[model samples]
Target: TQLLEQSPQFLSIQEGENLTVYCNSSSVFSSLQWYRQEPGEGPVLLVTVVTGGEVKKLKRLTFQFGDARKDSSLHITAAQPGDTGLYLCAGYTGANSKLTFGKGITLSVRP
Candidate 1:
């Protein structure tokens, strides 16, 4: 079984500020994915990092997988009010593996 631990359960930041959220676990994973979700909606996948030490960028957001495949980080640059939402990290072990999600991080960006 895979378990993910996330830090900063809640974050309140002013617009244009920068922030970073982390997901970590002692178990190794085949891939890790990041997601964003808004109220009354399902989570939307932001990016998936498959290789250890791989990094992916989506606009002002950057996602990185640790070299050991046991951790990941999501950094947001110049946060905006529209970016306010819940962020989640999920890890997958294999094709038949169930995805394990961390306790979500709720971000509130103030204008």
Candidate 2:
């Protein structure tokens, strides 16, 4: 079983600041996904990177997949207090396409 691990399990930052969080694994993935979860709800898909070295931008957020497809990063620019939530990184692997996920990073953007 492949495992994806997220770094800096919790991050707290001020509004307007920029920060980047990471997800990495020793195994390769067919595709990588980023999800944002709010209180009392399931995680919502933010983006998916299928190819190596691919980058996608969503509003003030940027997502990148490492060339090896074993790592990914999520960067937020000009973060706002409203953006505080749990961000999860997941990947599809093996023939079964099992969804492997990390513990997630909780971001708090203090106003």
Candidate 3:
């Protein structure tokens, strides 16, 4: 089984600040996904990067896949209070495999 680790497991920032969270694994992944978890609900998929060195943007959030495809990062610009939540990263080997999840970073953005 592959393991994913996220750094700076907790983050607290003021509104409108820019921040970046990382997810890493020694094992190479075929693809990686970013998700945001809300209170009393499961994570919601935000984006998936299949190709190495690919970057995807969703509003103020940017997702990137490392060149080796063993790591990923989520960067948020001008973060708002609404962005405060638990962010998760999941790696996929293939269609038949299970999702390898990181412990996730809990963000607290004070307005």
Candidate maximizing lDDT = 2
Q: Across residues 52-99, which tens digit of lDDT does each residue of candidate 3 receive?
A: 999999999999999999999999999999999999999987565888
User: Model 3 reaches what TM-score against the true structure?
Assistant: 0.95
Q: Which stretches of candidate 1 lie over 4 Å from their true place?
A: none
* TM-score (all chains, Cα) for each model: 0.95, 0.96, 0.95
Candidate number that wins on lDDT, 1 or 3:
1
Model 1 gets an lDDT of: 0.94
RMSD to the hidden true structure, all candidates: 1.5, 1.3, 1.5
Candidate 2 stretches with Cα past 4 Å from truth are none
What is the Cα-based lDDT of residue 76 in candidate 2?
97
Off by over 4 Å in 3: none
Please say which candidate is ahead in lDDT: 1 or 2. 2
Model 2 over residues 34-77: C-alpha lDDT tens digits? 99999999999999999999999999999999999999999999
TM-score of model number 1: 0.95
Writing each residue's lDDT as its tens digit, candidate 1 over 1-100 gives 4389888899999999999999999988899999999999999999999999999999999999999999999999999999999999998976767888
